[model samples]
Target: MLSETPRTRHRRIKENGRTDPADLHAVLAAGQVAHLGVVVDGHPMVVPTVYGHDHERIFLHGSVASRSLAGRGEVCVTVTVFDGLVLARSVFEHGVNYRSAMIYGVPRAVTDPGDLLYGLRLLTEHAAPGQWDYARRPSKKELAATRLLALPLAEASVKISDGFPDDGDGPDAALGLWAGRLPAVAAWGTPEPDPRLAAGIEPPPHIAGRAGAALHPRRPPPG
Candidate 1:
């Protein structure tokens, strides 16, 4: 279950709040990037990074020298997927359609050799499926230079906005104006291989197969 602390509560737009822990998982699974927020020397900082998560925790990593990961205090990670734009007759009613999740927790640095490799595998697979097995694993020196943090998924807040403009039922409807959702969806393009690659080398099936697929795909139903 998702924890509902004051930090995770939806005080204003309560109607859009989601309480199900599964919703948070779905949001995280669909998105590729996350904004990691932390405080450094009494100042706030937010750094965008790639993340991976399982049923209980999220994995975030960066260079060991990165200031964003130097903080030992609380951290907030947010993932947002913009679905579209909700245009209304009135400018005041214009809004966007999106799915977002915010997680709050103190992250613990991953140090154990086995755990570090496991977390790195999750991060790599989450960003590019099948790449871990296809590419060489990280060497010892590379692993030592990296810093991975694991945060519990126990405390999170999720909100989804999928509705059309509410002004349709109000006086704004009288205006002779067009109003609808302009969806912003992302699709993968053809793969561009490295120019220095050996001749005749082609993209693998997994990489080539993603062309034209949605970046944030709908979660398939479980069997």
Candidate 2:
């Protein structure tokens, strides 16, 4: 349940609007890539890029040489997941059920040296858990050339849909047209080490495991 406030109600959409903060957080955490919508030079642009979330805020990184991050004012970010395909009796009524989160806020460049390093670590870990420790940390020069942006999740909305289609009553149902849901999921493939890797260099545990095992399946069990 959400606080009974005008702002919350304003963002609420019938059936689609999700008021549970935990649900929203889960969806955000489940995703690795986010599409950032921003107004650049008065033109709207949506860029797909990797992101990391630290419970309270979302971190987005870009090359310091990239203009998208250098000249941004306020940015609108959206993360989404397609759950399944909803097939209805009528073609016009067919649709896909999905979960999505929209965040609207101003992005401030991370300036503090300590916070910058921490944010970078969070970003790195978000993409590859345990990789931060396994790989060399960024040097001062590398850090200097990286741009990190943090956006608070305080003002955001989650929309989700599950189950089958909603076809009109009477004639639609009587027509006996097939109606059901086709589930969709994401899976990871087996780990393939670099050909140049030393013969003794084994895959790290984190790398050996699938990224989205819960959503998908592990490697076709070893023969």
Candidate 3:
């Protein structure tokens, strides 16, 4: 799992070098939105948008005229999810346990007709599994107006912080402050169908299946 240098290690975090690709991919898959950072006019700009991945490449889309997607050079993409808040006894040690991925690479515009359609499918399905098949396919005019970019997972990094904080054997512990992790999780609510739909319309299996599932702080499916 080691590619360049491990970033999850305590020393690497201290050195500010992240190098775990699996951690990076996991964070990316867990998140539907990403902050795309790129240089504009020699200044840094981060744009928030939706993203999708196929385990080997990450896909992003925007309007054909979007500045973030229309530039002539490389772009940096990052996806982050905060699993919980780590409230340590010491204020200095308080932090968040999170999963994040950073990708640095040049994005190639999707041109081939087949690849473009595939990328769009990936983007839609990433937002919600089984959604693409359930929804109407994009029309020719719609497809022509959209822009898609794909970045290979060749150069990426993941950093994750988990478990309780380092707060024992400190003066703050003696202060008798209540300190521990305040767990945060994302869960989906019951589906509310559109009022304009046909009277007999019922929740589709794909949409209805998400009930009681975690939206953030995602967990692996049961065996």
Per-model clash counts, in order, read 0, 0, 0
CA RMSD of all predictions: 1.5, 5.1, 3.2
Per-residue lDDT tens digits for candidate 2, residues 1-223, read 4333443454434678877777667777667688888877778888887877775788888988766676367777888887789999988878897877787778878888898888888878767778989999889999899888889877777777886777756479989778999988777667788889889898788878864465422112111
Between candidates 1 and 2, name the one with more favorable TM-score: 1
Stretches of model 1 off by over 4 angstroms after superposition: 220-223
* Model 2 pairs in collision: none
Each model's lDDT comes to 0.90, 0.75, 0.78
Model 3, 37: alpha-carbon shift in Å? 0.4
Structural similarity to truth (TM-score) of each candidate: 0.97, 0.87, 0.88
Q: What does candidate 1's lDDT look like per residue over 83-136, in tens digits?
A: 999999999999999999999999999999999998999899888899999999
Residue-level lDDT for 187 in candidate 2: 71
Candidate 3 residues 1-223, lDDT tens each?
Answer: 6355342244555433445555665677688698999888888899998877876788899999888887468777888887889888877898888877777778898888899888988888777789889989988898889999898777777777777867777677788888889877888889998889889888889889988888864543111
Looking at candidate 2, the ten consecutive residues that score lowest on lDDT are: 214-223
Index of the highest-TM-score prediction: 1
